[model samples]
Target: MVSSKIIDRELFERILEKKNSLDKARPLSAEIVQKLRQEMEIEWTYNSNAIEGNSLSYEETRRVVERGLTIGGKSLREHFEAINHVNAIRFIEKLVEKKQKITEQTILEIHSLIVKGIDGVREKGQYRSGTVFIGGAVFTPPPPIELKARMLDLIDFVNKNPDKLHVIELAAISHHKLVWIHPFVDGNGRTARILMNLLLMKKGFPPTVILNVDRQKYYRRLKEADRGKSKPFVDFVARNVERNLDLYLKAIKTGKDEQYISLQEATRHCDYSQEYLSLQARNGKLEAHKLGRNWFTTKKAIQAYLKKHATKNQKLKFIQ
Candidate 1:
């Protein structure tokens, strides 16, 4: 067995620290929480559905979710997907509020809302009775007969958290494992992502969205997990968790350092070009996150990076 670490321990701890900061600031005014929640719900719906190939643009999804207005050019399935995802998120929020345990029925119910009008009633929340295959996936899902047993085992693993994994790790693994099982004929991916956030929210983390812009890298990480290198997938999820935490912290203005600016705006304060900063962000050298196609980082992060590198270079010059 490769004893290689399964996640960036430093980054993971940094995320936990941010979660701690958010927790300490809890009981944020109801109005602020409500506004942030509304924004995140729309974003979560749009991105999750888009990742599943829904054609509605972000604005169309906002209209569908917020105003119940359908787009003229989009198909009925796409509209339903956007609306249903919002409904599913609301359902998960209620469960989180009630501190409910994640049962098999709960999973089915979330899936039910996700595919309500798009899929037939028999397949709405029900596990597939026939085999299904994921295009571009490295492995086939377990056969239908194995799904129930596999789901039960998954529920046990999540509920018990037998390995005592951190909540983030548990949620990430559960996300991949549910997709690995591919229990439902459709809506498996959406359900797994929702279920993953449900675990996070129940643990006091804000709702995390896996952006549509990340669709390709997201699949690649999942495929890596399938090949027994789960670290990449876990790190990917953790980065997203940090992103949402940054959003929450910023929304409340929890601290001055939490202010995040777009890479373009951030460039005005730093020596490096936006492209170079984006590269550093992608390589994990900078503390930043992507919102859609744009990357955002704090002035503090830029200053820290420059300070660290400048000192390193000065030491090398001294040695020379």
Candidate 2:
């Protein structure tokens, strides 16, 4: 069971607030939903593959999945990776639509779509038959002999939610544990991420993309979890969830001030300089997320931060 200390309550509540906002704005027009779904699918495919060292540029990935065109300088495997991932996303979406219960077979099917035409036929959806080690990962996976039991335990953990974990907590912990189990000889990272999103989507939350730019931080947090310091990893996952919720709200134009602005622009309402705000954003201190190379935060998020940190004697400076 994850300790209460593992997740930041403020961050967790912020995600719920934003998720509720998106929900309240629900039944979006088909055209808008379709457009947002398409944009997310491409971004999700690009980032998930990029984290695994796929060299396909975002546009190259878009072409491979959308146009089915072969990229000139990329390997067939890389192109296949892009295609396979989008297929995997669709598989999960269907499962969500049907409200399917996640089971061992369900996981296997997800992994199968991820590695199809890439891994050998026998290994495509199958657990490793021998021991394996993840490069640069702090912990070794359970041996092949323990794989089946470990996986069944994971499935039960997710289904039962014995600790009554929040959906996001359950998803993040399950993700870390799956990667820890190292169920497959390959594609475990991608599979874990997809499975995590499956859990999120099941709860009516949007699919969260862990950006490729945060790849190093992602691995570092996972390593921290392996070392029994789980908070950083869980918080890391929570931050991404909040970011996507913000994105969804922005796409739907849910509120007048819900849009994210560059940190430089955000400084107009607060005493912090752009550099300081960017630093806070990177540290997860301010409610901000990255757009490409720069950090973006909402005016509302800045006001919340100010209110939280201001002394009682100091009147809160509202962002008007």
Candidate 3:
């Protein structure tokens, strides 16, 4: 729904720069890629399900998905949601490896994997047969009778104009439009997210996971999209993708010792208090950024800042 003219050109260029840097670091060792993929499987599942109101914590989701352990006090549906989302991620990986095209059947297959054992067994891969309403949403989906044709049109539009927009924009718009269609009775949010990642992976970018912590902003952006102004939502998705690119690039470009750690953790290697380091980061004295209200900087960045400061202090002492 975002028109090209409305896109923030500066932000778009910044994401492309990050993405291009990622591509230059290509052919990451298979082992590293596999490890990152495994970690992402659990994290992506947890965040995606959490956004949809699933109560499983990050640790619980990891246990359920990895160990097949039944968590105490958690509903069977919650467990299924966790397991189904990982399975869906695996399915998407296979599709990416095969370089599959995006189509209605492909979308349904992904949805089927997502809702396999959940309450909507009968409607797992099927569109809605009746009206449905999104709670707290300002816009309503099209009537059930019009759903199929509209979905086909969406697919047709995507396939026809694959090169008309930036890849990130393409993925974000696909995500917004799918949510607008609201084809299925349930799992629409999760499925749209998976579809968005599918588009990203197809374009040779890493699959992005929108943190559950950003759910409020996420929904707010979607609501903005409903009002026929989609730049906000598109920018939201682009920021997520940028964050993901930063993560991947940091992992591959740096050695095992150069981790992107919290400021508090960075203090273990230095004599600065957490407050001081955070203040430095806030004032741009350190190369760091806030992720979810916490400042994160690499040891390399901190070391660089400290070395520069030490040199400056020595010069001042000599002058005295």
Candidate 4:
């Protein structure tokens, strides 16, 4: 059924062009790259765990992962989830650096890292021993007996079709298929997301963080994929990927200075509501464009607009 789904070639090419253009721009220094990776490591772990109902707040997750401090209200498992995810991220980074191939062994090892202390020793890194149902999901995962065969088949498909589909499509489909399998008793979503990033990183793309704000939409897209339509999920993933690329490109060009940002982000630096900003963007009063579904513009653009509109008695406020 996934094969039957139509690929949005136009959208895919558009995202690819943005990605390639960023790659062609000035190369980021190693220090800047590492700093960006560290920041994303925190965001990626926090968002991935939060989507799965982990009780740790983003700040709490940062404390647990970076500061190694325990939160007062969070359970040990929640803390472990945060810590383990960071370790798993580190593991994946090593795997990427080594240019490792995706295989059952790698998947299991990653799972092992993710559930090291949270799951039973027997369950850690092992496939589910029984059928699993996702609450409110439109489709159920395959039974345990079929998981191995299905996983192998999926791997074979990915390996054989490397040249058939674009890398983003390949990674997106792999993510959907992994979730459909629901290979482990726990951590399936987290593992699938990490693995998807693994594939993306392998292709020299940045890792995507599906923000907690988008959790509902993320699940909705996954459900759409389950019903044999993969485009929505693929498009969702691509948008996130595009957003990350935009951020990284902007950061590299601006050296952590004020740069292009989404309307929601821009609101923090200005007096305009997101709705007002959207209108301004639509009217071309602000130099911005709709990337995916959100409008993006630089701080300089906003500053210029303010200066042009400032009254003689009023001083223009710029983003600081």
| Counted clashes in each candidate structure | 0, 0, 0, 0
Which 10-residue window in model 2 sums to the lowest lDDT? 310-319
Cα lDDT listed for each candidate: 0.84, 0.85, 0.82, 0.80
What lDDT tens digits, residue by residue, belong to model 4 across residues 1-320?
A: 12323456666666777777767764767765776787788889889998989978877888888789988977898999998999999999999999987788888888899898774546888888988899779877888999889988878866676547766778888998998899888888898888889988887888898999999998899998999988899889888888888767765565333455668887776777899989989999988755333567777777777777655443244457
Q: What TM-score against the true fold does each predicted structure earn?
A: 0.79, 0.79, 0.79, 0.77
Better of 3 and 4 by TM-score: 3
lDDT of 1 by residue, 121-150 (tens): 478889999988988998999998999999
> Which one is best on TM-score?
3
Q: Higher-TM-score candidate among 2 and 4?
A: 2
lDDT of 2 by residue, 278-313 (tens): 888888888886643456688888878788875654
When summed lDDT is taken over every stretch of 10 residues in candidate 3, the lowest stretch is 311-320
lDDT of 4 at 222: 92
Worst ten in a row by lDDT for model 4: 1-10
Ordering by lDDT: 2, 1, 3, 4
Better of 2 and 4 by lDDT: 2
The alpha-carbon lDDT assigned to residue 39 of candidate 2 equals: 74
